[model samples]
Target chain A: MSTFIQQLANGVSLGSIYALIALGYTMVFGVLKLINFAHSDVMMVGAYVAFFVATGLNAGPDPSIASALITFLAAMAGAAALGIAIERLVYRPLRSASRLSLLIAAMGMSLLLEYGGQVVFGPQHRRVPDVITDERIVLGDLNLTVHKLIILGVSVVLMLGLHFFVNKTRTGTAMRAVSQNVDAAKLMGVNTDFIIGLTFAIGSALAGAAGLLVAFHQQGDIDPLMGVYPGLKAFVAAVLGGIGSIYGAMLGGLLIGVAETFVAAYLPSSFRDTITFSILILVLLVRPAGLLGKFKPEKV
Target chain B: MRGAAIKLGFLVVLVGAAIGIDFALREIFNPHWLRLIELAGIHVVIAVGLNLINGYCGQFSIGHAGFWAIGAYASGVLLTVAEQKWGTPSAVVEILLLVGGMAIAAILAGAAGLLVGIPSLRLRGDYLAIATLGFGEIIRNVIVNVDAIGGPRGYHGIPVYTNAAWCIIVAALAIWFSRNLVTSSFGRALVAVREDEVAAEAVGINTTRVKVIAFVVSAMMTGAAGALYAHLDGSLDPDTFKFTKSIEFIIMITVGGLGSITGAVFGAIVLTLLPELLREIHPTLSEYRMVIYSALLIVIVLVRPKGLLGNRELSPSAGIAWLRRKFGKGTA
Candidate 1:
């Protein structure tokens, strides 16, 4: 029972990170109908930014709550700027082209960020200093790390904030209107570009937070290739939950995290990736629209 | 009659000049140049095969490298292990063994393609891309875990039989097959599906059949390229056939006009050479190769969305017209 509880905690913490990143993917897909492959790399950029800020300021080698908050804020800002710039420069020009063209461009953007990060940061891994050093809490053989609790707590706060923002704010209403019908939203005089840009910024900031949270949970190590696996997993979560549904992205992320953890723990590590992908393929084959996704016919 | 004679004469001259240049270059340049040419030729085969599925059929498959790895390993295991088991090792027998190995690999990769294509074809666009990407990852993981094929450590000790003559022969065969396939009735159906699947289906075209056929053919050719790659390298590693490698193949297809054979060849040659040239200029540029390549890809798409050739193939008559324009009609 204790082992199960520990696994459940691990799953939720991991799932929280996946859910955060997957929300960005699902939101972009909902609004633009384009799979932004570069979003994953943006998350990578966020982690690197936070790593540099924490290390350069000597905040990490000596753990301090104030420094962590400042670094996290700086990372979020940097990621938001990068996201806005990418949308304006690379993707905005090809907005009128076929989805394939946009997809190719997104991939190009992804490669650029990944390799450019390699060039600037070097290929080696940099460790993030642990700012949270609280002792593990033991409850009758169920030991939970404080870092995991922080990750789960931060993720919940972010998700709730997003929910409130999307459901309550005027811009969120505009975003929903555009996603439901771009032409009708335009007819209603909504500034599509601004909404789109804001969506990317908000989504990218969430990814940035997720990156930092993950860094904390893993003890603050960042590398150029760190984004690829998590990116692919988040994409899988998005697909499994329902590509364009925000709530679905969250659910999918959590389910995939649990599934992956359980599979890895039970099955051989070699078969772990295969099992995860097999589940995706099976899910896709059974429900083309995904688990929580509802199918809407394309506009002819 | 005059036009026909002019076309025939131009073709003859072009073929003669090409052969002359090939022979001259062979004599003047060292073996390294020949090797590069051979490598480019193999990539041409792979890229052209990818073009049929991605460019012509409008399917986004990022798993070509998985099939390539399958073909390489399949052929490598047969040629090396099977030869040892049999113990004959005669030249004719070895030739037959190699051919058999290649055929089997093609068949296996083609079958794998069918398995991936059947379910994926039901969805449109990005979903298909994700499915194919998943398939590639699955293949990589399976290869890494399977101990029989040496797993992640890779396979070695395959006899090297890839040569200039074999590379040229394979390139010619692939080009001819792809060109003929694109111009035939089946090819027209593929283009129709690519343009509008619903419209094609309304017009009685079996979109699924056409897609499956093109996918299988593409896989077979990619497998053949893999066989050649295995022989050239004399070893096969799982790392060589990763998602990035598949993206490289996609890059070749994208830069080359989708439906143009000549574009694939041009893309394969230029991209292959550009990296080598960049490496020679500055060693640090090697690390930034992917960054530069991706940036150039984005810029090219924004600037010329239709690609360099835009569905046009190079022809002897076009070459003669260019020559005549350059020489001003009285050079002879």
Candidate 2:
């Protein structure tokens, strides 16, 4: 029972990270109908930015709460700026092309970010400074790390914040309007570009937060290739939940995380990735629109 | 009469120049030029095969490397295990085994494609992209876990059978096959399906069949390239056929031009050569080569979204004729 609970906790923690990054992917897809393949690298950029900031300030493994907060904000801001720049420079120009063209371009941008990051940061892993170092709390045989609790708590809060922002804000409504029908949204005088850019910024900020949380949880080891697997897993979560549905991405992330953890525990570790991807393929085959996705027939 | 003479003269001069360059490279370089030619040939095969599905049929498949891996392993296993276990096979027997290996790989990869394609064909653009991407990942993972094929350590000790001559022959065969395919009735149906699936279906064209056929054929061709790659490298590693390699193949097709066979060859050659030239400049730049390559791809797509050739075939005859008119019989 304790093993099950521990697995559950690990799944949720990993799922939360996947959910946060998946939100960015689903949001970009929802609004622009383009899969930003570089979004994973964007998350990597966020983690690295936070790493640099924490190290620059001499913020050791255990930093003051205020310093941690300041470092996170600075890192998120840098990530947001990078996201905005990529959108404006690389993707914005190809807005009118076929989806295939955009997909290829996004892939190229992904490679650019990954290799560029490698070149700049060097192709080595950098340890992230641990901000939270409290030990685990044992409750009868279920020992839960304080860092896990913090990650879960912060992730839930951020998710709720995103929900409120997308559902309640004027810009959020405009974003919904554009996603529903860009031509109709444009006809109604909504600035499509502004909404798209805002969506990218918000999505990337969430990725940044997730990145920081992951760094803190993992004790701050960062690598140029760190984002690739997580990014792919997040994408899987996004698709499994429903590609353009925000809530669906969250649910998908948790489910996948749980599924992966259980499989790893029960099955051979070698088969973990294979099992996860197999689940993705099976889910896609069964429901092309995904668990929460709606299907719209292709327009001639 | 003058035009005809000029065209003939230009052809002679062009052939002379090509031979001259080939001989010069043989003398100056340490067999590196041959290797480059082989690389270009392999890429041409991969790119052209991808063009059939992604370019002509308008299906977005980023999993070409998965099929490539399948082919490489199939060929590698045959060359290493089968020959030793059975007998000292003759040259003819070995050749037949290699071809059989390629066929089996194509069949296996094609089956995998069908598994992914049948249900997901109903999904549009980005969704299909995700499905294919997932399939690619699944293939990689499966290869990693399966111990029979040496798992992640990869298969080695395969006899090195891929040479410049073999690469050129395979490339020539691929190009010829694709050219014939795109001009046939079946090819027109593929084009129709690409243009508008609904309309094509209404007109009695089996869109699903066309899609499946194109996808399977494309997978097979990519598998052939993988077979060649395995032989050339004398070993096969799963990491070499990752998602990144798939993306590189996609870049070749996109930067070359979609729906153009000639564009595939041109793009593959130029992109392959550009990196090789860069590598010659500085070894460190080789690590940063993908960054530079991708940046150039982005810039090119932004500036000319339709690609360099954009559905146009290279007209060697026309080029020769123009050159002859300018150079006045090539001073002959």
Q: What's the lDDT for all of these models?
A: 0.84, 0.83
Q: For candidate 2, write residues B52-146 as lDDT tens digits.
A: 99988888898888888888887788777875798757877866776776677677777777787777776656555777888888888888888
Going through the candidates in order, the fraction of native interface contacts each one reproduces equals: 0.73, 0.82
Model 2, C-alpha of A153: deviation from truth (Å): 1.3
Which regions of candidate 1 deviate over 4 angstroms?
B1-34, B321-332
lDDT by residue (tens digit), candidate 2, A170-273: 88899999889888998999999998899899889888887887776676778887889889999999989989999999998888888888889889987778
Model 1 TM-score (2 dp): 0.93
Best by DockQ: 1
Q: Candidate 1: lDDT over CA atoms?
A: 0.84
True contacts kept of 1: 0.73
What TM-score would each prediction reach against the true structure?
0.93, 0.92
Among incorrect, acceptable, medium and high, the docking class of model 1 is medium
Pairs in clash, predicted candidate 2: A128-A220, A128-A221
